[model samples]
Target: MKRQGGFTLIELVVVIVILGILAVTAAPRFLNLQDDARNSALDGLKGAIAGASGITYGKAAIDGVESLENQTISAGNETINIDFGYPADLAALEAVVDGLEADWSNAASGAAILFGYDGYNQRCVSYTPATGANVPAVTEVIEGCGTNF
Candidate 1:
């Protein structure tokens, strides 16, 4: 009698069971990565908005543009609308950042806009124009971002 060069049926079954268990344990971690990625992207957008606001404000000051509603100033190659020497609205913030795509909604008071990414339904970046001597504010909301993806 010759022994076959193959796994026994019991051994194969055990191997499959182990693989199934591993997959069951690992699946959730992999599934959650998409949400993590979306959160990270939103964080990056927040940083970009803050940086753009600062740079645009500096440029407006250097060019002697008065800090007033509806005034526009050149920042790098893009024009940023100003509200008291800060980014005026969502459009101005989008202009400063350039090439960023998101859904925008006006805030209740119309003093800010909420920019949300398509896949990240709950996550948003809020852009609030400066009031009085205060600088513009950019806030990121990652906690309420839906995990539909």
Candidate 2:
């Protein structure tokens, strides 16, 4: 009797079934990376905003105008306008720090500046400028971070 070298049919079927199971379990994790990326981007943006707000407030305090609203101060070549020691608006913050406009869009709503990721303005960070008595409030709406509006 000649000895055949090919594997049994059952072996191929088992390999295919294992691959399918792996794909089923791993696909979702890879798919969710987009969501994770967007969320992380928003978080980084929030951190930048918070840092800028703090720095601007420090500058305002140094000028002895921390409690005053609608004040402008010069840091390097950038002119930062502040309200109650916090960057008055997104524009002011952008002056203190760059690149926000490159990837993000913002709008003013009531007492806060709403910054949306990419073009989805609804899913973003809401930055409320300082009210003299407290630090600027930085909050986010990531529930729709990776989804289309």
Candidate 3:
């Protein structure tokens, strides 16, 4: 009998089984990586927020005039103007941060998350999921201590 140009039925079945096994073994690792990424992103966000607190409260050793009217925080290239008393200031930041946090908590779960500022002269952080879901989401606003407005 002449040999077939393509794989035989048994050969195909074997290949499929091998692929399935490989997928099964790799899926967990991939999932774990996703979790790690999410976690990292969150950590970065927290750190940035912490740093922002100092800036907002004038506690940082850095020398600069801190004014809510014209003060701004930059993470990388993303810059956010801080005007806490303005009618729209808190609301706007809250909206952006809330949505992003929800997305991160749901999408990334436990991945090593990174929150940066000034991503494009805009105060926003980019959350990278373990699955490489680079969602440039807005994190919580950098709230200042004793900021009534």
Residue runs of model 2 more than 4 Å from their true location after superposition:
2-6, 119-122, 135-149
Q: Which stretches of candidate 1 lie over 4 Å from their true place?
A: 1-6, 64-71, 76-79, 101-110, 145-149
* Structural similarity to truth (TM-score) of each candidate: 0.71, 0.82, 0.35
Q: Which of 1 and 2 is the better model by TM-score? A: 2
| Leading candidate by lDDT | 2
Candidate 2 residue lDDT tens string, 1-149: 99999989999999999999999999999998876787778788888888877887788889998887789999998888888888887788778757977767776778877777555533577787777656554545544434332
Q: Largest TM-score belongs to which candidate?
A: 2
Could you tell me how far off, in angstroms, the CA of residue 56 lies in candidate 3 after the best superposition? 4.1
Clash count list over all predictions: 0, 0, 32
Cα lDDT tens digits, model 1, 1-149, are 99889989999999999999999999999999977886777678788878877888788778776456678897567777787777887667778775554433333225656665555566766677787545555555545533322
Instruction: Return the TM-score for candidate 1, rounded to 2 decimals.
Output: 0.71
Q: Which residue segments of model 3 deviate by more than 4 Å?
A: 1-3, 32-34, 56-149
lDDT of each: 0.69, 0.75, 0.39
lDDT ranking from best to worst?
Answer: 2, 1, 3
Which has the higher lDDT value, candidate number 2 or candidate number 3?
2
Clashes of 1: 0
